[model samples]
Target: MDKVYDHRKYEQKIYSLWEKNGAFTPKVDKSKNPFTIIMPPPNANDPLHVGHAREVATQDILIRYHRMKGNSTLWLPGSDHAGIETQYVFEKKLREKGKSRSDYDRDTLYNMIWDYVKDNTGVMEKQLRQLGASCDWSRFKFTLDEKIIKIVYKTFKKLYYDGLIYRGERIVNYCPLCGTSFSQLEVNYIEKEDELYYLDYETLTIATTRPETIFADVAIAVNPKDNKYKKLVGKAAKIPLINREVPIITDRLVDLNFGTGALKVTPGHDPVDFEIGEKHIPSIISVIDMEGKMINTPEKYISMKASVAREEVVKDLEEKGYIKKRERLHHSVGVCYKHKTPIEPIVSKQWFIKVKPLAEISKAALKKGEVKIVAKKYDKIAHHWLNNLKDWNISRQIVWGIRIPAWRCDKCLEWTITDGVVPKNCVSCGHEKLIQDPDTFDTWFSSGQWPYATLLAQSRISNFQFPISKNDKAKFEDFDYFYPTSVMNPAYDILPFWVIRMIMLGLYATTRVPFKIVLLHGLVRDRFGVKISKSKGNVINPIEMINKYGADSLRMASIWGSLVENDSSLSEDNIRGQRNFANKIWNAARFIFLESVAKRGGYSKAPTTKNSYDLKIIKQLRVTTKKVTRLLEKYRLNEAAETLYDFFWNQFANDYLEKTKSRRKDAQKILDFVLQESLKLLHPFMPFVTEAIWQESKNRFNNTTLISSSWPK
Candidate 1:
């Protein structure tokens, strides 16, 4: 053994050995039960943040643990094209080069982003390897893989034929920065401070945060139950800036306490107002264009952005004495999750999925406990999301994802949908020249099908389709072993967006649960409890930490104190302490090997029961072994990690090895036996250093490699 521990030398060499020996690959053994996990695919084009590192650690712990338990374990690795998010990143790069997507045709831009995603995928896979992830690289998939796309297309075709998909001109959450539309799940609410403008109308005062939308207002809405505005409901109110007279309508959806008793109704601007106006107003007007600039208004503010036009319209209203008063207020504003820009609700033609049926089916399965969430608290959250499910907007107006396999007829304006090919002509008419919808499925649409797609792709079954009508699960070779994967481990924040959709889509496609368990890990936040992001300049780079403190320390520190489905704070002190533990492990191994192999001329055989010190530590080892195994089975990695750390440091190193140093031969045997078994127990959480120590002290291990060794008995 070396005199001092230095991890920079051993981590890369140990990982290379594992990879070269195909240690990560699983066999198709029917004798052994399969334990599989599909890695939650990360965005390919964006640099992987610390959050990715945390997930890799959590997933790897389970994969390695199951492998030592003699199961056919497979951790399928992948990357997502991340439709809108990837295009947003690529477009920012294009903008820096003074080019945009409009500068090229659809094929040209798609191919360009393909290259970008490919290059970044390579970089990301390398990072995952450096972080000691044990996912099978041979099974690595890209969400845009040809076979995966076929599955996505097939699912869409079946949904369309089943009357679950629709095309309509409804209000969509639009992101001007990304030049795309987002699903409601992709938008988050933030409390924003803004001014509330009270406008003076003839009969009543209307309060609005967006006076620029006055040009689009078709009515003023009041709570039908409010007596103060009962008479005003039948009258007409003039819009302040546009001076257009819109009718006053009463509806119960209006909040009477928000601003005034009445609110401005811009059907094309707000989703709630759109619903209300659809009932009372005769027409809908759109003044803000998709680019978030004023349009269909007076020439003075026609080209101004929404923010600039708001100031101009407010100034005009104040000068005309139509403003009653102003006050500051905080309200929830819908913003894009990726671009961080305020979402503009605009009426646009897009594709949607009726999720109610799927949600109900999935909820029934959850009620039966067919699929269990690790933390019981998340069960209510999952059930609530399922109960209140809305139609999923599955289409994105971007070029970086699987384009919808549907076409629109130029003559009849009807859609012709297919599985994986362009229709010869419009299904409704004999038009030979049909144009495909220039849109892509939302990234989640493809990702929701990941587990089955990746598993089925390994087989030659060409007849696989959705709405499975048979009981045979052996049609696909890999699916037979890996279907109903052991667990779906992902961050809790994506529970609704990804996990729920996976359950719904998986059941619809394969007629089986995607995974038996859903284990959600917490977010890795900064010390101040803020999310770690590059925009905040507080990003903790995992590779840098690996280079400094080593991979085992980083992995141990990430999973040590994290609770399931909660956010955890990242601390440099925690990582430093874990590094000290790694050194302690290394030094203890050195002392045992020196005494047993070199000084005592290779001591062997178990210590006799006359030595109670040895017996006491052995009994404690059995208890620790039982406790750690139980904890790992329960998806409690944090508690398991703490158990190993306490047993190895406090019980074995500090107490047992110290108190029995005077009994030469008996102490050496007990020391060698306990140290070897402890390394096996700790190998899952801190693989690199423990494996390195196992290799250097080869006489201690019965197996050639620590990773392939059995759990401590």
Candidate 2:
């Protein structure tokens, strides 16, 4: 044994040995129950940050623990072709080379991005291996794989035929820069200070934040309960600067206290007004184009950006004596999550899924305990989202995702949906000249079916294959065994974006919950509780941490610092402390091995009952073992790690080892027993160091590897 512990010398070699020995492959034992977790696929376009590192560490702990407990454990790994994010990254690269996506056709750009993501996916997998994640590499799946795409298509076709999907011209949250519409979950709300414009029209007043949208106003809405606007409900008011008359209507959706008790109903520009206007108004007008430029407005504001048009319209209104009053107020504004640009509400034709029925089933599954959420506090959050769920928009105007498998006939103007192949002729009109839908399915539309698609694609069932037409049924044996996986673990930020949708779609497609347990982890933030991001200049690279400190040290630091349901802050000092703990482990093992060899001939045999020191240490180990097993069973990981740390460092090293130094043979036997059991408990969190120590003393334990060894009784 060396006098000093150096992690760099052993980490890579030990990791390679474990992989070569197939330590990560699940044992196919039908007698034991199965445990499965589908890794939340990271975006393949970027390197992983600290958040990804935390998930890897936390999930690896669960997998290793289950593997040792005699379960058929499988952790499937994958990556996502993140639609908007990947396109944004490639666009920047194109600009550097004096080219753009517009320079080529759709096929050319899609193929280019596919190659780009393939290279990045390789890099990310290497990083995961360096982090010591024991996922099943043989069962790895990608979202864009041909077999997975077939499953996604099958789900879409099923939804469409079942009357759950439809195309309609409705108001959508559109990002002009990305040229795509986003679901409500994808928009970020930020507080902004803006001028509230109160415009005077004849004898009535209308309040609005966006005077630029006045040209599209179809009516004026006021609360029906407000007595102040009762007499003017049937009257007409002229729009400022446009000289257009629109009816004054009564609707309950209006907030009576906000700015002048009257709202300009611009159905084409606002979500709340869109619903009210669709029921009460006769026509809808659009004054903004898809580029977010003022389209049907007056000459001065035409072709101007929405923000610029707002400034010019406000100036003109003030000069024309139409401004009743103005006040500065802080209000919520929706922005694109990808580009941070202000979102524009535009009415466009897009595909949508009726999620109300699906959410009902998901909610009932939670209530019935078929799907259990850890940290019971999150039950309310999951219920709240499910109860208030709206229709999901599942279409995007991007070329990098799975194209919507619908075709439109030019001769009869009818639509035909083919499950996985392009139809030779339209089913509705028998027209050979048909154009496939230009839009693509939203990225989440494919990802929501991840659990079923990934498992079914890799299944051994020969009956389930790709290019499945609408007439063919899709079923697989792997899904029958692993459909309701053991757990679904992800960070809390995605509870709405990814987790909830997974439940809803998983149930709709498979008629079963995706997982039995929903384990929600919090974000990995900086020391001050601020989220780590590249734009904030606070990003921490996990690879650098693994290079500096060993993978085991980084993994231990992550577990020690985090609670299962609470955010954890990262700092250099934390990693340093964990590194020191790793050193303590190595030194403790060294002392035990040298003492056993020198004092008791070779390895110490099991000791008989002898001294108070030996009995006390054995009793404490039993108690620590029980506590750790209970904590891990309840998913209280940090508490378990902390309990082990204190017991080994304070109880075993400081007290027992010191007092028993006089009885060399008895001390050696007790030390061997304690160290062997301790290695088992710590193997899940610190695999490399514990395994290295266990292998060095191979003659001590019948030459069984610590990884495949059973947990302490």
Choose the strongest candidate by lDDT.
1
- How accurate locally, in lDDT, is each candidate? 0.86, 0.85
Clashing pairs in 1: none
lDDT by residue (637-702, candidate 2, tens digit) is 889999999998999988887786677666777788888888889988888888888877846753
Q: Clashing pairs in model 2?
A: none
TM-score of 2: 0.96
Give per-residue lDDT, candidate 2, residue 661: 69
Q: Which ten residues in a row have the lowest lDDT in candidate 1?
A: 598-607
Candidate 2 residue 690 C-alpha distance from true site, Å: 0.7
Can you tell me which runs of candidate 2 are displaced by over 4 Å? 460-475, 596-607
The digit string of per-residue lDDT tens for model 1 on 74-101 reads 9999888888777878888999999988
Model 2 lDDT at residue 141: 92
The TM-scores of all predictions, comma-separated, are 0.95, 0.96
Candidate 1 segments whose C-alpha is farther than 4 A from its true place = 240-244, 469-472, 528-530, 535-537, 596-608
